[model samples]
Target: MSSGQQEHEDYPVRDEQNEAELQESEAGDEMKPVKIPPRPKRRPRKRKFVAGLLAAVLPGAGHLYLGLLRKGITFIFLLLLDIMALLYFSSIGMQINVPLLILLALLIPVMYFYNVFDALQAADRILRFPEEHDPEDGEDIKSAASARRRVRITEPGISFGVMLLAGGVLLFLFRQKPPWLQAFIENSAGAAAAVLLIGLGVLMGIREVAKNMMARAGKERRSRRIGRYTASATLAAVGTLLFLDWSYGTDDMMLLLKWWPVIPVLWGIEYLLIYLFSRRSKPGGTVRRARMDLRGLISAIVLAACVFIVTEQEHYLHLWNRVSLNLTAAAVDYGEAEGHQFEKPPLVVPVELNTSKVSIDAINGDILIHRAAVEDIEIKATVWVDQLDGVLAEAIADQSFVEVSEGTTIKITPQSKAYGESGKRQPRINLDISLPEDRRFDLNVRTMNGGITLQNVEAIADISLETGNGELILHRIFGNVKGKTLNGAVRARNVLGDVELGTSGGDMSAWEVSGAMKLSTAVGNIKAYDSGDAVDVSTKNGNVEVAGARAKLHAESLNGRIHVRSADFGGDWEVYSAVGDIELFLPLTGNYTVEGSSGYGDITTDLPGLVIDKKLISGQIGTGEFKLRVDGNSNLNVSKY
Candidate 1:
């Protein structure tokens, strides 16, 4: 009975199940025949050209226009940082940091082009993968956007932090200048560069370490790049060596710069070590070595080229010295502080000889000759030695003396041959001499590294003065004066005879000369006032000014103006300039003939009777006796005094 009843019930259930299975199969077949439409294409962004133009004009403008707020702000911030750095370097007025300033200057164009290209690429990326469109691939687009956002935010923040750190370091250096830090700040570009590279390497190594830590924490499938670590370590090592040399005042860094071939050898060794250590066993039973990608190769090439250029340059190859520092108007504080100064007692010498001529020679000291009422010659010598003790200085000073020679010349020498034999520890000797003012004597003075001053002295003969690198001054000298210097100024006042002065790199001036004057300089101005005789002045690169000249006057300049004021038309006057103007002032009642011509310029006359015509000026105020000739490459102006 159960079999018969179950058969009927099972038959209906089996029929219903069969029908349900057939319906499901039919639904599956229908769905299989229908295919999903391809993801919709994102329309290209409008005004793409305008966005690029804006980016070209301003680094971050295009990114802002493309709705990338963070990226745009980052670009702008970097641009501003670059500008501020440039301004800071330029405004510092320190010529020593020129290389650093140039390096920062080059970042301007690099950042500009990168920002433009990045903006364009960002627009293209949006066109290819719109955030809101393509619902089927929404997850992929979101992940891609998230990755880009992370990179944009992380890199800029890291850059900003690095800049802040550098600024803080510089501020600290400027505020607290320690003894060792002075070497770094004393016009040594190499030290600063080393610090920069070391800081950058440290930052890079820290970034890589942080990335590895984060990857491990997130269980991300990422392999570390060995090239980055190698580069960072190399930079840090090189920078450390440079810093050591600079801080310790050693010549090791300079030697390294000269022997630049060692750099390539070291680089090869680094690569060999990297190859040996970077090998890793893979899952396929094979070993793999690290390989530099395109980015690394480019970076290495750029860095090598920069280093080679800097090291090979003649100017940057050597460290700055005291002479060079002084040339640039920088004080020789470091070098000067290395010496010990010592003063000795005065040495009195009686002039028992009937000689009226006195001569003094110094190796490295200033000489001052003063007029005194004493009958004997008084001498005071000051010495400076390289050693800390005063013994060397006193020894050097003891050997110096004054004596009456057999040739009737009173000889005063500050240092003897023993001082020269002292080698690098040789001392500097400065002398002060007092001579009798009632008697007229011939003065002869020469110095190597010191100034000469002779004031209120009655010289019976020509007063000769010469210096290798110091100034020469003559005041109230009643004789012919001759002065010459290699790198210092020449000034004379109240000279009673002919005056002759010449310098290679300093000004020459004479006031109230009672005789003819001749002044010349290669790189400084020439001025003569109240000359009683003919005044001749010439310069290669400076101005010439002559006032109250009653005799023949001649002034010439290679690249400066010539201005002459005549008290009377008593002699012929000639004024010329190679690349500047000529201005002549004459008395109104003089009988003079004026002849003036200017090349590529006009000649003007403010006198009542003189006129300028066709770049030439020629006229006469009365019966022509004296002659005035002015010629130059620039303008020429003649006027009445």
Candidate 2:
């Protein structure tokens, strides 16, 4: 059987066993896990202290530290751009100053993003390769050492302190002036100094406090806190300025210095105190969380204050002045001194009527007629000397007048002048009359520049009073009243008759009126309160406010708002405005034919009896019962509760 044959068979078996061993080795290699080295833990790098100091001085220096050359240059360019924009706006007569300010406002976000990104990248770079610390001095080492030793005394606190000192010095200098000068200084400089000191203190306080708080907070919360604080401080400053300006009539600069500087200084002090506390506390016991909740609360309070101020301003501007009755009339003639013989010297004819009716028409002075029970007419006539060279009062006292009529027709003329020992001209003669109370006759009175007031008068027919620049006041009157004024306000209170009041450019207010009230104004608002029966008010350019109106109300405005509240209407209610919104409030059971429409707005109605016309959605409201029309392109909704 041969040794060669056995060896060959053993060799094949040996090869087969070798192949199995190779496959087993390959399977074990697939199942085994490979050893991998752990990635080095990333540590944020500490930026060079010099870089931070430089950034504090000039906004983008930190980017330069991270070798972001283009960004650093861009920062400088933006700063220059802002300066140039400010100068350009100043040169443009300040009309475009708002646009420049808005541009600056937009730039703030850009600068913030740039600062954050640069700081993050700089930190990353520092962590990646920590600058080698050398015990032996080198150029970089010396530079870093010098930067660390550099003291920063130009911070906001230091600047504000310097300003405060300067202001105090100026105030002291101004206070050393003479009495008149001292008064002027007190009015201007002393007030200004006080405001400046307070403002500086507040600003420094807030800035220091925020800075300290941000340092204690982590990166994620620091920026948010700073932003919230800045916004809150700014709003507070603006509000304080406005309030001071309105109440005291101070200039904007004085107001700002009075209030704004105090916030920063106070905040800064608070921050310093907090930092001191943190430094004194045990290392692990110091709280590390950011004060985000506190900041949010402050922001909310600021917003609420702003809302309150806005609402208060709205109400104050809407309130109209109340009307009162104090009547005075005077008429003087200069024609007598010119030797012009007068057909009728300014006469005071007191006539009494018995029918609750009185009327007057004077060309230059006021004519006042109060209702009383008079049986006949009374006249008081006084004539003045027609003197050319004497004083007006002397001529009037030197002259006397003879009564022309006894019953109603009273006509008197001015007499010649009397010469004095000093050769001075004097007046001739005039008459004076006192009438009975129970007069109902038609009395005529006229005036040009004096106001007329009718109080507690009962007239069956009518009373007319017209003035050029004086106010007309009617109180507790019973009868139809007609009043006209050129440049003064007309006020009617507790009038139990039909009222027709007209003003050319002043405000008109009617309160506690009984009969139909018609008020018209050219430039001021018309307000009617507690009006009885139907009331009709119209204005050309001012707002109309009506409250507690019982009867139907018809109000029209050309350029302002119409606000009606708690009004009940028996007949139709109509309101029209050309350029403002109309707000109407009624009771749940208030019923009438309601019609409302707007030209370019929606009609909102809470009235149940409203019949809305779809096609004229911009023109009218309600159906056949009541109609209200408004013209604008705003929102109008009618809701029923």
Candidate 3:
């Protein structure tokens, strides 16, 4: 091409190249990533009060807020079952285990309140913590140093309260003047040790609970609390050993020693739940993986060792082979009772009177006294003229349980002698008194080695009978019947009377009575069948089953279940249990308000309008008044009816 033509072409080519370069630069600018705006954190709804209120009314309702279908349904099902079971078992004549029933009852309030608090807390988190709601900022903020430092600790007042409680218990012992107290006082060391151990246990338990509430979720706090519990338990075991060896009889000592193994098992179970269930709730909670508390483990091992040592006592081994699978009755003594019974003349001694009181004293024989239409005093005895034998009997009777006074007071007493009246074989003289049934009279009889049978008797005054090792049978007796036995059953039937009977180691049953009844037993079942009037019954180591009882009811048991059925309910009823379930089988239409509590278990009921608050289960049925307490362990399946 010519020079001018070449210059033009070059200009056009250069211009085109410059345009392409500029266009490429512009495209590059368009392709560069844009600076995007960040998404805003979700603003949680403030519905804590509503959520908690719903949960309180019905367990698992709060979980529904989180759209947790399975959890919510499970909570409702379990809670409803707990309460329904209470009503069902009670109606079925207690065809179920008492402890299990009580445990189910206890779950009502526990789960109910737990869900309430849980819902409230969860609502607060969802509403107040927007940062935590964001996926990018999911990491939890570290807790404040001050928050960790603030801890709840047992104060000086708690220690003082512990001392006061100890003192109060001791005072009660003295005031009650129980038969066992005399023996306990004679052995001061054992009594002191028992009291000390009880105090220690109570104080430590209080301290531990407080520490748990105050302690932050950390290994150090857990270890410290474990050490405290272990130390307290060790002290209790040591004290128990000393007390058992010095004071408690061989049987009681052996039983206590064998039960020591339960301590470690319980401890292990509790710790297992704590560790296995512990989870990180907040983001900062996972800053470091939670470690097993070595100190706590060490203390727990020490506690186990102490329990083992207590259980493996040398003295208990000899009795271990004879370990009774069935618990012995508290009042009934096994193995033949070795004692001398003087056979008095088998005679009917009836003392007719200007005074409506009849008194008779005996050394050792059954006292059979019944009325036979006689108006005056009749001494129908084998005339083995008895004297208190003030000098000889007192000196000879190694064990005499007798007390009688002169005058219009009817008295019967036991005369015990290590050596009987020499060769007399004391004629077996039983009293069969004849009295006019038209007039009522005050009657009192007592015996040591034989039973007391009072039949076809009518008394204007309170009739009292006592025995040391024999049964008491009363038939068609009028007036209040007060009977006590140390080693026998107390039974009364077809009597228009107010019954007050107590036994240490035998069953007690009262049927069809007119007035209120009070029955107590230490180691036997108390059964009241088809009886009227208010009933006050208690047992220390046995079940209390009331098939048909009415009116004001007060029943208690320390180590057994309390089963009650009443059609007539119109009084203040108080029911208590230390380690057993309480089942009430009564019509729902009855007018009675129920107030109940469970310490370590659950309180549940199926009846509508029942309210469960934490450890409390309360509601009004008709409109009477009553109170019940179940001091079962945590998750204790017990509720007093």
Clashes of each: 0, 94, 35
Ranking by lDDT: 1, 3, 2
Ten-residue stretch with the least lDDT total in model 3 = 147-156
* Top-TM-score candidate index: 1
Q: Give the winner by lDDT.
A: 1
lDDT per model, in order? 0.70, 0.53, 0.59
Pull out the clashing pairs in model 1.
none
Which digits, one per residue and each the tens of the lDDT, describe model 3 over residues 54-172? 78877888767644344465577656555655564444311122333445566688788877876676666556543433222224434543223211110112444554465456546
Please say which candidate is ahead in lDDT: 2 or 3. 3
lDDT accuracy of residue 243 in candidate 2:
48
TM-score of each prediction: 0.46, 0.37, 0.40
In angstroms, the error of model 2 at 202 is: 87
lDDT of 3: 0.59
Q: Which stretches of candidate 3 lie over 4 Å from their true place?
A: 1-353, 375-429, 600-604, 613-615, 624-641
Comparison by TM-score, 1 against 2, better one: 1
Error of 1 at 430 (Å): 0.9
Compose the digit string of candidate 1's lDDT tens values, residues 576-624: 8999988888999977888888988877777988877887888887887
